[model samples]
Target: MLDRAGYDRYLAAFNARDYDGVADFYVDPPHMEFFGIVITSRQELKDFYAWLHDNVEENVRVLNFAASETCTAIDAIVRITAKKDLTRAALDAKGATGFFPITAGVVQEIRQFIFYTTRGGRIEKVECALPPMALETV
Candidate 1:
């Protein structure tokens, strides 16, 4: 089970772009589902973030959080600064789920609900979703 302290550390690692530290919080075969795209292993998670980092800088700020023995749920604001233009067509072609129009040097913010299922203090699965009307200029 992941407690609040552990989850906080995970967020810190992520916000710092410590990819290996972030991966260490997950199980060996962790599952991640972002919208319709799915990542079923830790290596894929690392690769996905690496690719995403190349295109944009992302930071997540938690608005609310709750944790139980098995699950952790979070409401957060995700801020993304585009390092290079990411067009809708290009993202679609690459199956990059949960991404929107991003013009180089522009910033966008959106609200999301993220859930993680934990086992033995490591994340076993993660799922994320947007609230209706989630996108707004910051």
Candidate 2:
């Protein structure tokens, strides 16, 4: 089970743009889903982040975090600053789009509800949800 501190370290590594360090918190074959894209291998996870970081700087700020024996949940804000222009065509070619419209030199942020399933203190799967309209104002 990953405790608060362990999760904090993972967030630290991620916000620091330390891809390798962030990968250390996951199981060998990580299963991560974000914005409808599924990554089922460590190399894919690395590659995804690498490609994303190449175009923008991303950071997550946790508003709330909770962990139990097998699962962890978080309410977070994802901030992205685009380093280069990413047109819809380009994003579509990559099979995805920015969380919001992104223009070079622009900053965008959004709230996300994320869940993680862990095994042996390592993350095995992750999924994210958007806040419902009812809770968006809160």
Clashes of each: 1, 0
Q: For model 2, how big is the CA root-mean-square deviation?
A: 3.0
Query: What tens-digit string does per-residue lDDT give for candidate 2 at 1-138?
Result: 888899999999988878899899999889987765678887888888888889998888899999999998999987788899878777767766534547888877778888999998999999988875412211
Which prediction has the highest TM-score against the true structure?
1
What TM value does model 1 have?
Answer: 0.94
Q: What overall lDDT, based on C-alpha atoms, would model 2 receive against the true structure?
A: 0.82
Q: State the local distance difference test value for candidate 1.
A: 0.87
Residue pairs whose backbone atoms clash in candidate 2? none
lDDT of each: 0.87, 0.82
lDDT of 1 by residue, 24-79 (tens): 99989888878556788878888888888889999999999998888999999999
lDDT of 2 at 4: 88
All models, RMSD in angstroms: 1.2, 3.0
TM-score per candidate, in order? 0.94, 0.89
